[model samples]
Target: KLDMRRTLSEAINIQVPYNFERVMYLLSGGQNQTEAMLKMEQTQVITLSKDLHAKLQDWVSTYRVEDSEMLGTVQNLWGCHKYLSDPHTAVGVNAAQKFLHGTQRPCGAVICLATAHACKFEDAIRKALGSKFWDGTVLNDPKLMPPTAGSLQKLPEISRGTFREGEDWTQRLREVIEGRYPEATLVTPHLGTLWFSNQAMAMLLGITTAVCFAAILSKFARRSKR
Candidate 1:
């Protein structure tokens, strides 16, 4: 049920789906013994049932978009809103626009999630916005090229290990981990505190909605009066 194409959407749109078994195989460092041991502990594959799958199909409507459309979306957003969006986010926005304009248009606001920073996908950005603009403006712009990008690029490799076909990868990984940290440390997880109370949040949401509604009503009233 997946389409595999050579597009800007590299992360999600894949040829073969990496299932739980494939993940375990990777985590085991390609060691058959380690993979078997991991499988013994957790072997259950969670797949949606027929009814649930049917219900999901009924609820969700997926739109297929071309690379050209995604690029156009990215360019348009940048030109109009001064917002430089990544290819994946562009895909979502393009899809959302298609859905809104299509025959079965939904009422609610479609929030296209901007998952990653534009700096992360430099090649894609360069393609969307011409190389001339990218080199001249985007390269010098602090907002586009953040300090963290340079910092990340300058980061040294903490640990390195090779997993050869005929070698014991588990032992190799063990050696690497031990070399990095001789003694294992137990760190307690910190829980995040909520900023807003339930009542306060409800009141804020109500106010925002009321303001939006009032604006819409005012716009319509003016149109009718005209």
Candidate 2:
């Protein structure tokens, strides 16, 4: 449950109320994310933190979410409705409502996609509500169990093969370079932060890979002469 994010909470929340009669045993840690992923489900995760927010760009279509506006919307909703909306959902709904108001569009109803459980971002919610969140209906609700503390203590286990920030990404390249051109040097470029420009680095990596192969062939020729 400790590793649980808001998106997963949204899915489970829907599953529970939609089928409350049956016992929905929620799996956590590696069991659900790792094991379930092994089944070949076409899962796509969109995280704004990574600047891979291109996923939501398609969802919003025309609307662009800015820094102050998005958080401002989230906080506004929290203080007003006592509803806790995660950053993703907050940006989305806030954009939609603003657009509709600006256009003066008259419609029967406009549906905004709220993707996460509020309990998942309890701290963020508290901040949004100005640390006066205990008065809110969401975290104070008696019917629901806390997301992190359900019937059991949360596990600190991160999924295997998960990408850690500072790991040696060039380890495999280093191995090849060491075996072939022991004299040659390679520099690992520090990608400052995750953004679309990372794609340009990807193309650069492809070119470096070709250089690696050339070095490997050079080593092979020298060995054959001996």
Candidate 3:
């Protein structure tokens, strides 16, 4: 059985991707010879040069956020800004807020990049906010959900392909990709059409145009100030 404690900290309710832990173990010279680590030994690994590593250590400041803190951040952002944030974005925001209040605070705006739509992390959002909040804002309100979200939820059939341990999983994956798996069934597109419609294209074009216009206006405003 896999050790949950290695990938997830039960005390803080914090979970990290398996590959992340693997890389860290390799870099830190951890000695446990796991199957994953043995396989990684065959592949070429890149390391940062001493000078670049020193420069990064000098410039970058990282802060840790617990699951509870991330959840609190999600709640606070929603309450204060009326903005829904996924847990991943909330973690970054929480860390950014901490840095701002810390001794080495910067004198500029701190932009936290949102990784995904709030709907993608429904469980995290539901946990952060209550069921009542989720019902009111998401379940009952159709307008609150993104257009692509509805379509995604309505997908007719989904399948998972599994490979056993000690098997050549990579070769099996290659066979699947090459359409050699007799049991594998290909899914035809629903409605016999592509997912991206002309409306979506138009909306994307409009957003791009608006961003370009805003950039030009900002440049002019800066020049005027000068």
Candidate 4:
């Protein structure tokens, strides 16, 4: 009983139950930030000094006040409720509840925008929201096609060459052959929908990438020739 209690307490120590600072920080940002928003989310929990309390409070009070449109955008985006969530989502919920009184109708849902993968805050989520709050699908990459028998058949046909020793790919092939392919090989494909646009800005980025890549490749070739 003592050991179990100690373990539970250790778990609870890392879990952020209700952090006013975090809630304040999330709500202080842009009014409406989408999943594609490139802003570096300040997630590191900060314990404010006594002197900074008034300053922080002032910041929160004025946060997005100058940008009412952004405030409305964020509020509208987060108006719904969905049970699946994370800390940032919890912070949003906390904000909406405190400010918006949560959803009004019985049919309303709580839509949560999970800011980070659940594993990063699993202990915290489990402690504060309970373990069942986590669904096994948090980190799943939906972009990847599930392995099919057709894929397996094509794999053998695509590579009939015998595995060579002393190479990582060869070793991986050996593992696959030996039926020992580790879960570490599980790859998550990227969904590259996050993009910043504005035709002029995009053209600049394209030109920049081209110039950089050209310079890099030129240097690589020169080094190889030497």
Best by TM-score: 1
lDDT of 1 by residue, 1-226 (tens): 3334577766665443435344544444443333333344454324444754565465456788898999999999999999989889999999999988887664456788998877777778888898987778776787887877756556553322333456663454445444543322212222112222234434545676799999799667655654
Local distance difference test values of all predictions, in order: 0.64, 0.48, 0.61, 0.39
Q: Which segments of model 2 are wrong by more than 4 Å?
A: 1-60, 103-109, 132-140, 143-226
Report the error of model 2 at residue 153, Å.
Answer: 8.1
Model 3 scores a C-alpha lDDT of 0.61
CA displacement after TM-score superposition, residue 7 of candidate 3 (Å): 8.6
Model 2 lDDT per residue over 106-162, tens place: 233567887866656555555555555534555456442365543322433222222
Clash count in backbone of candidate 2: 0
Off by over 4 Å in 4: 1-59, 62-83, 102-114, 128-226
Q: What is the TM-score of each candidate against the true structure?
A: 0.54, 0.35, 0.51, 0.23
After superposition, the stretches of candidate 1 with alpha carbons farther than 4 Å from their true spots are 1-3, 15-54, 107-109, 153-167, 174-226
RMSD of each: 19.5, 19.2, 14.5, 17.0
For model 4, the run of ten residues with the poorest summed lDDT: 1-10
Give lDDT for model 1.
0.64
